[model samples]
Target: MAPWLIAAILTQGALALGLLWYLGTIRIPMVMRGEVRIDDIALERKGWPKREWQASNAFDNQFQLPVLFYVGAGLALYFGPTSLEVALAWLFVVTRYAHAFVHITDNHVIRRFAAYFAGLLLLCLFWLDLAVRLVLSL
Candidate 1:
């Protein structure tokens, strides 16, 4: 509802679009062509189709999940700032980056699962927050 909140949501949307672009231009292409190892520049230095590249795709996917969340949360905020929705929005951003980190460095099951859980939790929160807003408004 507030202009600042809308701006924040817009930024979040842009971030999501950036992730989508990364997926389309980079991930999908590399996956399709079987060109691994990040970029050909990396390949020039080393080789191709490395696990890191795959991990990067996964990382981006993880980050993308939050985009939907912020959009939802932002809409909810237009109604009012319930801690629930704001908290969920924050969680969405955190989990996304955490997922990216785990994919990049840790690459552990626990970390991955936490990231997944966080994302799913945020997704659930979006609807719950929205529902509350609707019910309360009515």
Candidate 2:
């Protein structure tokens, strides 16, 4: 993989790590203080505070569309990534960060959706670029 592509992937990984840290910071204390129950949370995350829930949901979101990002990245690495692919990768990372911000902070559905959609579009473009490259090479 190119250094730039690795950097983009690392940045996305950092975002996920940061969200995990944030969730733990919020949730561990709540459990310690009896603010929430482990059993309750274990069963579909019931009784979690709104803030914790949002953070958790944002963390969970990382595994969804970003899975595609990882797969696309692997393909890009194998096929040799173009500058456009690198740019799209970085842009998708930015959009995911934006989506997480809106989801955990204000919890605004429209804003979150816009960010998510933007990331999705970027991911699609990245895959499309890879597909075209592969077809052309063949």
Candidate 3:
């Protein structure tokens, strides 16, 4: 496996940790204090804690955009990794981390979207490279 592949997997784990920490900080106290019932936070119409919701949303965002990343990285492993591909992979992961950071912090939309768009551009580069490789191989 490429070093970038390993880094990508570790990045996913890091994102998971962020989600766990944020949500746990909120839910654990509620449970321990018995301030709310299961249905209160679970099924009821009550809104979630803002930061916790942001964390959860960020976590969901991971699965969506990063699926392309996983595929691109896996293909790169099979095709043999290029330095450019590896660099772009790292860029995507770094931007995603930034996006999550912005989300859980002040969540300035412009900053978050900037990071998100940068990742998308990186993803597109990965795809474009794959396409070129495919055409060249034929």
Candidate 4:
């Protein structure tokens, strides 16, 4: 596997750790304080403390956009990208970390969107790179 793919996996692991950290530190307190019941932990509900809620939402965001990232990394590893592609992959991971930070902190929409869009652009670059390689090879 490519080093970039390993970094991408680690990025996903970091996001999962964020979710776990929130569940243990934030959600557990809400449950203890009676702000949220154990039953209320159901995904169908949205009754968490503000920061905890944001953490949960940010965690959910991981599953959404990062799926594309995982796919891109897998394809990149398989296709063998240039060094620039590897750097872009790392940039995408860093942008996700930034997005999560903004989301779980001030909940700043514009900052989060900036990070999100930057990552989106990186993902598009990955796809474009793959397409160009495929075209040149054929």
lDDT of each: 0.63, 0.94, 0.81, 0.80
* lDDT, model 1, position 46: 47
Q: Which residue pairs does candidate 1 place in steric collision?
A: 1-78, 36-49, 37-49, 37-50
**Candidate 4, 31-115: lDDT as tens digits:** 7789888676676556666777788878888887788878877777788757877887888888889998898889899999999
Indicate the TM-score of model 3. 0.87
In model 4, the runs with Cα more than 4 Å from the true position are 39-43
Better of 1 and 3 by TM-score: 3
> Mind giving the per-residue lDDT tens digits that candidate 1 earns over 25-48?
755675567765456544353443
Question: What lDDT does model 2 reach?
Answer: 0.94
Give residue 114's lDDT in candidate 3 (0 to 100). 99
User: Sorted by lDDT, highest first, which candidate order results?
Assistant: 2, 3, 4, 1
Clashes of 1: 4
TM-score winner between candidates 2 and 3: 2
lDDT of 4: 0.80
Best by TM-score: 2
Model 3 segments more than 4 A misplaced:
44-46
Per-candidate Cα RMSD to the true structure, in Å, reads 6.6, 1.1, 2.0, 2.0
List runs of model 2 lying over 4 Å from the truth: none
